[model samples]
Target: MNFETVAPNAVPEGAPLIDVREQNEWDAGHAATAQHLPASTLMENLDQLPETDDPLYIVCRSGGRSFQVAQWLNGNGFEAINVAGGMDMWFESGLPIVSDGEGEAYVL
Candidate 1:
């Protein structure tokens, strides 16, 4: 179960970043380029994932949930990496964030 992990700042621009937080959290704020894929319903929405051999970067509010999802994805034959420290660290690292609305994007 040795899944890979990367810091938020290390995630390259345009990489497929999947946010595994819930609807509320996603609506609050998230990485500007991240895709919404709540961990609760991820399995049912596998079709939404990018169809590429490249690594899929997963994130949550913190790192816990995304870590679990990354492990599951790897076991299921996908190259997924857990974003260490998640959105909180992403925000702390001064990365760009966007909300569902026009307001300021803060980590939820």
Candidate 2:
């Protein structure tokens, strides 16, 4: 019930950025540092997520999918926050984006 949208800059270093969009959508654009863990695959790879209970930023092209993923992550054990407005906002705000093979995809 304490869902909060983290500011782009507030995103800490080395925290996992969960991208819940489909592969095609992700290939078009995404936060460069975000991980390609589509929501469909999240439940299967929860073990790969960082152990910290802090908060992993869940994002998508829009807010819908990311919101669902965020809720599920909340029920799991890790603290998850949805990036409000999702990738649209991140891009509109002039934050960096990574297209298919255009830039770095992982932070660590």
Candidate 3:
């Protein structure tokens, strides 16, 4: 099945953004409004995904993982869009990022 992709800056504001990075990476930093859903356990956490017809934007450190996740999700009947360049581009684009820790947000 075909999958969609969008650049970090192209992701719509308030859209459902899912970060598929690992726990340590997520803890380091992530998009302020993104939901954490590590790719490793994505299958087990299917129920945690947002329930909506709207497109789900998937992101990771550099887009590879997110692309894979997006493909799987799309094949499984989800409207998943991979975030091209992922969090790295998001950080470089000056998008808002927050850390689960107390330190300033910086992509891991």
- Number of the top candidate by TM-score? 3
lDDT to native, each model: 0.93, 0.76, 0.94
- Write one digit per residue (lDDT tens) for candidate 3, span 32-95: 8999999999999999999988999999999999999999999998999999999999999999
- Winning model by lDDT: 3
Estimate the TM-score for candidate 1: 0.95
**Stretches of candidate 2 exceeding 4 Å from the true structure:** 7-9, 101-108
lDDT of 1 at 60: 100
Clashing pairs in 2: none
Per-residue lDDT tens digits for candidate 2, residues 32-71, read 7888888888778887776665688888876778888888
Q: Where is model 3 poorest over a 10-residue stretch in terms of lDDT?
A: 1-10
Error of 2 at 77 (Å): 1.3
- Least accurate stretch of 10 residues (summed lDDT) in model 2? 99-108
Worst 10 residues of 1 by lDDT: 99-108
For model 1, state the Cα shift of residue 84 in Å.
0.5
